[model samples]
Target: MALTFTEEQEELRTTLRRFLADKAPSAAVRRAMDSDEGHDPLLWRQMADQLGLHGLALPEEYGGFGGGPVELGIVLEETGRVLLPSPYFATVALAGQALAASNDEAVKARWLPAIADGSTTATLALAEASGSWRLEDIETSVGNGTVSGTKMFVVDGHTADLILVVARTDTGTGLFAVDGDAPGVTRTRLETLDPTRRLARVDLDGAPARRVGPDGDASPYLRTVLDLVAVALAAEQVGGAQACLDAAVAYAKVRVQFGRPIGSFQAIKHKCADLLVQIEGARSAAYHATAVAAEGSSELPVSAALAAACCADAFTHAAKENIQIHGGIGYTWEHDAHLYLKRAKSSEQLFGGPATHRARLADLVGI
Candidate 1:
């Protein structure tokens, strides 16, 4: 599988980046983040209908563009740079994958078409209060056509039309689909470090749920979707890191100090250089993971884990360094630096944190 983007891929990035810059500017992000819905449905439609981004990776039979994971990675990177406040990631990376990978064709038929058409949105409700990525941490039970318990860290949970819940069943862990507004389903918006991505606490007390997969171990598909999500997030983190680095360099070049640009100083140059090197490394890891995912390579687990851990740290570091380089103004809420920092912090924990992925990596590599 090729690690580099093709000409068509580059064109996709250019198009997406331009679109996001015009429509999803920082002001738009601020407005969306402050709104009750945490995202603009209109913008979501524009992205899906106009850009055809929502179906980039699904099969053409499902109304998709029949692209692959690399295309999705490009879309994610561009969206991350602008902090797009949409449920595209949750819908595509989480629920879409769960349905696509599950054993039940009925569930796929019921969901994939609408998802591919961007008519409905969905997310995977996996991690619980334990804050663990392990399937065992899922306390929700799926038995007798009901789901019981709570799921925390559900991305875009409040707005998802459908929720693919991971729950324990009589046979083993299984996947279940529950309507967002179904009876006994409660979603409480949680105040998060990053309001750009709305998170909610989902409570299911005997909520009506239909089985979406076989009544057996769903670990393989679960892991597959989670890995893809990790790869997508890693791409986003790399984008944020690159943005922070660019912002720091631009500021350092213009902000005069001692009658010259502050960037002339050895200290400032060293900081920027360090960030550039790390950001590039993180980019390589994320890109390689994306390419691997696109090809369905056997090395996906290790690549995804590495991308998750490396990109998380690199993005966080780049954001912190950007703030440090910017001095006092970066700390203010008005500045965009803090927004990227908050996103970095929030993303580090989604799906699994760097440390969690590090452990997973060790096991996968047999180290």
Candidate 2:
């Protein structure tokens, strides 16, 4: 597939890129990351209430734009480009996708409206303390109207208004919705490596559990949610890699070495050339996956896995090369290169490492 964006999509990307450049510059992102709430409420409100980005990909019944994954992919890419320190990915890409996969209309009617309007934020808690992404690795149990055990690394778990808990049921894993402030539920913020992305530990002591899908065999729904999330994340990685490459090239043009621009050197040229190749390849794969997702194709799993591994490695490579290209200044805290590097490293481990996804792809394509 060509994986080209429509004119409307290009316009959307331009608008969001301009908006984030103005509202979420490196200084703003740093401030938000260090703030008490760990994000800018006002900025988030503007992105949601003003731009209507919170509902961009949701159904019209839930007060959204009724768009598909392509729109969501655009927003996520812009957010990644600027390192916007909001719960956007966790809320929209993860939780929103999960809720949309549920078979229960009553549950959707209750939750989707609030989420669509930006009146509420939510996250899906799937990874347990073991930190495995596999569905079978989940150990937190839910049965007889109760949930037990704990989940870790829940994005925005501390501040979200709603929580979607994936629990071990009698038949298999089940998706449950729990009110954030419900009794016997605890959320503690973790001191994560990347402060821009919030991580929380959620402990549920017989907390209320309501199955969002059918009572038995919810793995298909979970897989669907994960595939959607992977496509979004891959796009984000491409954006970040693009930013890193831009920064490196810009620096190479200005920084003089031996009375000439460093970019003229064969070594620097080779590094930049290598980065460009990786980023372009990753971008192609990511955009293809996003396009496939918009079509709701059955090939999503293989595409998602390919995009995930390709984008993850590309972003990490670009970040590291960006720092190396900058020489000394990139090593300091004052520079923004490290921020992209940190986020790139964190994102690599978010769903699972690149190696993990490649392994999954091996089975997904029967290689």
lDDT of 2: 0.89
Give the Cα error of residue 295 in candidate 1, in Å: 1.5
C-alpha RMSD by candidate, in order: 1.1, 1.1
lDDT of 2 at 363: 97
Model 1: residues >4 Å from true position, as ranges?
A: none
**Model 2 alpha-carbon miss at residue 5, Å:** 1.5
Q: What is candidate 1's lDDT per residue for 108-209, written digit by digit as tens? A: 888888998789999989888887878877788877899998655699998889998888987888889999999989998899899788898899998999
Show the lowest summed lDDT stretch of 10 residues, model 1. Answer: 96-105
TM-score of each: 0.98, 0.98
Tens digits of lDDT, candidate 2, 1-367: 4488889889999999999999999999999999988899999889988789988988888888898788999999889998888988888898888887675788888888888888889998888888877888988898779888765569889998888888888888888998889987999998887888988999999888788977788898788888898899999999999999999999999999899999999999999999999999998899889888888889999999999999999999999999999999999999999999999999999889999999999998888
